[model samples]
Target chain A: MSLFTQSISPETLSVATLARIESQGGIDPFASPSHPPRVSAPSFRLPARAISAITLLALIALWWLAAQYKIVSPVFLPGPEAVFRKFITVARDGFVDATLFQHLLISLGRVFAALAATLLIGVPVGLLIGLSTVGRGVFDPLLEFLRPLPPLAYLPLVVIWFGIGEPSKVLVIGLAMLAPIALSTAAGVRAVNEERIRAARALGASRLRTVLHVTIPSALPQIFTGLRIALGAGWSTLVAAELVAATRGLGFMIQSAAQFLVTDVVLVGIFTIALVAFALEWAIRTLDRRLVPWSGRD
Target chain B: MSLLELDHVSVRYQNAVRDAVADASLRLSSGDFLVLTGRSGCGKTTLLNVAAGFVSPSSGMARVDGQPIAAPGADRAVVFQSDALFPWASVRENVAFALRMKGVPRRERDRRADALLARVKLSGFGDKPVWELSGGMRQRVGLARALAAEPRFLLMDEPLGALDALTRERMQTLLLDIWAESGTGILMVTHGIEEALLLGTEVIVMTPNPDTGQQGRITRRIPVSFGRRYRAGEPVRAIRADPAFAAARAELADAIFEGELQ
Candidate 1:
């Protein structure tokens, strides 16, 4: 009785009703009237992880083949296995007079020293140039002149002044790292929206308060970008500085190994540098994600 | 005393050959809504900027509450055409920035920002990044940011010009609602004549700079008062739709665009 009251049989329905029912079966509302079939948006495709793994395997195979066939001398191009053996030897017997931990500590210490000094000087100068018309007028030209000079160019002069010591090394690397950071910071500062500045002023904020609350917070992402660039510069500059006149550190080991033509040792040092650079880069990316959580995903 | 007054104010940029605005004077009372309408480059922006103390007059002077205006101050707040929210900040952070500058504590500043955002119909958008917002939503955030300061005067320069037609209409009604609640003095600049007619309590039609000639010398100036203060003399839409607006508009257009004011 309930079924009879609530429903009509398909056979009993009229042609118009049947057509409406048929339309409900498969017709998409969004389909264009002129087109027989609906147009669907193309879905995005991501590169598969399996593809990346295969690429890695292919690269390793090529390296092994080159080494095994003597396409390059073993002295110059050690097989992956040989390189791994050297790595295990270093891990056990150390790279030089110092252990692996000692060399790492020295490198990390140098980087930290240079970074600290750069931050101390770069941020204030950047903010000054960014915020003040007078400061920009005075300092911008000076900065532009200094920014392009490579850090290696300063080593000879720094050595003459500070004489083959850690101080000279630190000064060279720190100054090299300073330019990009300060410039990027200034750019960030200048790019702060004028509306925010005006609004801050309208709220009875003193000049100092405006700079502190509005300007600095707005310019932070750019400042972080500068720091990342500066870190890279410092790392590369540290290696170059160490290469010139150093008794310790990975760069020194590479330089010493190159002199003796111990390509295996040199290769080991090169691999270590690459590994450390990768680690530093990964740390910076993680820092960026954490600090600027709203960094333009859209 | 008039709440704000412009005394023979004229502005000329240093490189420009002619004054952008010449010998413009007006008196505005508190709670008054003033709309400025003219041909492009007839100096509507220059006049509003001078009034807000963003730009100085090349000649004459401007006064607020009988005091001579000199620089941008807390008394006047501006809503810009671009809706320039800081892209790096979340909507809440952007709204709270002005308050933070004024030394408001963190708790209070956040509270006030939330309230202001609510006023602009953007209550839950506080934590959203600016880049994630649509154009209309960004402009609403801008309006809320400006209103957060609670200034004595509000200066808007084509604040809704970037929005689509439907959004623009909605924004206009929203602005009217906010105005009714706040009662702050407003000076708005727009190229849309109908918008001026709909929004202004007092409408001032500006003439383009004139050259010496019979037609050029006869620049029309009319004051439109509407609604409760209509004075039983003129119909608002009829006055706006009248042939006089067209003639004035054309004459100003010729003066500005053709440089043949006469």
Candidate 2:
């Protein structure tokens, strides 16, 4: 009966009958549909992003509930409203001699500076390792030695060598970033399609030109992947980096607030760090889409 | 010497194995259409690679213009089975790659690239990315990119092996047209027996050893003239319709699978 209302059947399914059915306003002469066909949403589908958003909402609600009921001391886990108010206060009134924006800017500067350093040093070193057997022999062990060492593990060493200066903080962050960039670049270079190199060489590109035009361009996607990983590494290393006598940074602010038992300010600092990292990640993903749109399309 | 020659060439890899190619030889001259066909494991591609200067013969000679072919060069451009175009570039930029390497001026190279794109029947597609094109179109772009070098010989490793049958037939015609117009010698490797007969003035059936099935060598060189007939203004369909084309195709297929068991 439902099939008759819809007017799709073995008779109607034929091409010759399909035209006749289309000519008439009534899909079925015997029974008209209760309403016109509604294009309903696709069934049994939940967007992954919506799931994450819901989880975040739940966590925030749980935080609010715990704070409202006074299940934990205010010093430990403040209400979202209190943290939000503190965030506003810091954004406007400043915290521990520097405002929230100033601390964020300072940390951003360090991360960017470290990133630039990594690019300058890592790309060439990676190219050497990828292209030269001797370079692989020389640098492979050194990189492997350094790559797994936690930023905290090397903090004392950096401080001892560089004397707790701004360079020391940047250097520690750069060290954390270096291996990802260099290794990813090496992998990218090594994974370049052999046929592309041959095609370029046959087109009369010199060895140097081939590397410059073919190898580097082909590896751009992977290099960008490395940069994203480096950003995450450098961001995580920020707190450790600032522990070296830093006066103005989110890490320093968080530590200073923690010592004073200013839970709201500490929460503010942590939230800002996470928010900024999220923003930077989104920005990088957008830029990657724009620049290397051809990366995995084929 | 022919424009390109492989004389008694054999190639052995570094590790424990038989020679990948054992004692194979062939010649290609200007405007000549030569095809290498065989079953898999027969090293037909290895022979084409030697001719392209991508691989050197371990014991014998691979030469162009009587000069020992040492590395991949402009004289013998190669089209791979995989259309290995740079994704970072537009189609025009890819086609102009050879001219760019030669330090050709910007305007001149762009014009030449456009001309080559037209030759490959892909007009007005210069600004498109390689990934945006279909398989056959990408293959055509690869052909245009190679032809930009104006190579004396074109070596291909099953350039049409990836396309559907209809696209393959169209490309076969396009390849012949380019050969007739440019006078570039061609050496191609393919698994298609009819394709070899349809496109080759001369076809070499490379055979793997019956005993070991590892060492590959040339067993028969069958000369055909279908590509030449098409080049000389005969219609493609009519040429294929000829009784001789069918006879030659059967014979080529027999030669390719000769040493293998029934």
Candidate 3:
């Protein structure tokens, strides 16, 4: 039979058959009717907010029960109320010499600075490596070598080279963010659909124009994924960097609190870090939706 | 002078034992619709790529307006089998891409894009993202994008091979309409025998030559009069249903299968 005229058998056209098809993840043959259909509210999957809220409440309840019953010892795992009290105290007075907000700002500033530096330097180098064999040959070995090494492995060297100041801390975090951003960008560029490139070239686009319009845009979805990963890496590296160095960030606050047996303060620091990391991830995802809306669709 | 000429062009990839396209010659002038038809692995697409400057010929030359095509240029545009539309761009921007590359003002390019979109019967779809379009509609957008360049020669590599049969038939009619209106020379590659007869002013059947140790060469060249007859305002269904059209299609199909057997 011609592809256009082929039809489902009569046995396959029943409501039961249609339901079976739908159950099997095939299209709902009865979704659209030939005549006016019944106007009914469409059903949807469970809302993500509800699921998250339930999970969060359950975890908090478990934590409260554990502390109330002394299951794990309050000294080691503080209750949610204790953490909340600690948060209020830190917000009102201070942690160490700086206020909670000040410590957060300092950590955030370091991460953002490192991220900005990473993007500025990494994106262009990544594109160059992606576009040119020579660039790849020159940089691939070094990037590969540095990428596998843990950021903390070279912390001593970084401190010795740049001194245990802001620059050294920033350098370590920036280095941590660098590999993911550069590698992902390069992969994105390399993974640009060959057909799109051909289409652009055939449409009379110059090499530079093709790279700007087609290559970069095509690579963007993957690049954003890389950025999200890099942000996570930078955040973790910031904590590591601050753990060994000066005294103004969340990491330093958490470390000093532990030394003084201030478990509630450490809990506050952990929650703050978790919340901020979550916010950064959400922001990147929102940006991805706005900028490259077509990324994952096709 | 011909708009596109391939004089005994041969393309062979590195480390390949035989030429992908072996000493094939063809010409496309304004108002010409040349179709290449063959079975799988016949290298029809390779030949089309050679004409489009995507693939370099190992011997002989492929030229446009008597100038050897060293690299892809604005003078020739290609409609790939896959629509290849930029999924991120709206239909208007995708169609206006060539003009935008030339640094044309946004207003003028959008205007041109609208006109081209209308020509492809996608008048109100200019704002839609390419991913939203169906396969046939995407191909139409691809055609509009190719035409936006105002190329002297339009090349296609199995442009409708992905569509449903009904959509393919509609697209064939649309393609003929565009060719009739634009008067641009076309060199299209296809595997459908009936499609070749229905679309081409001249149809060439390609086949791999085992004896000659060559991969692809033209086995037959048949000048078609039916497309001209159809273009002269005859009812499309009537023309397609005619005995002459059926005979020609069958003859071409037989020749292709026979070449395959050889």
Predictions in order: lDDT: 0.72, 0.86, 0.85
| Deviation in Å, model 1, residue A209 alpha carbon | 3.2
C-alpha displacement of B143 in model 2, angstroms? 0.8
Model 3 lDDT tens row, B1-262: 3578999988889999888888899989999999998877788999988888889999998888888988887778999988889998999999999999888999999999999999999999999999899999999999999999998989999999999999999999999999999899999999888888888999998987756545888999999977788789987788889999988988898777764564
Off by over 4 Å in 3: A1-62, A69-73, B210-214
- Of candidates 2 and 1, the better by TM-score: 2
Q: Over the full model, what C-alpha lDDT does candidate 3 score relative to the true structure?
A: 0.85
lDDT of 1 at A143: 70
lDDT, candidate 3, A27-78, per-residue tens:
7557668735657887676788889889989999999999999999899999
Q: Give the runs in model 2 whose Cα sits over 4 Å from its true position.
A: A1-46
**Second chain TM-score per prediction?**
0.82, 0.97, 0.96
lDDT of 1 by residue, B1-262 (tens): 1387889887878787777787888776767788777666667878888887778988888999888888777677778888767766789987886676567899999999999999989989998988789888888888788788777788888888888978886786677668767888888887766566556776676656445211111133445443223333454456557776666455444433344433
Clashing pairs in 2: none
- Give the winner by TM-score: 2 or 3: 2
TM-score for each predicted model, relative to the true structure: 0.78, 0.91, 0.88
* DockQ class, candidate 2: medium
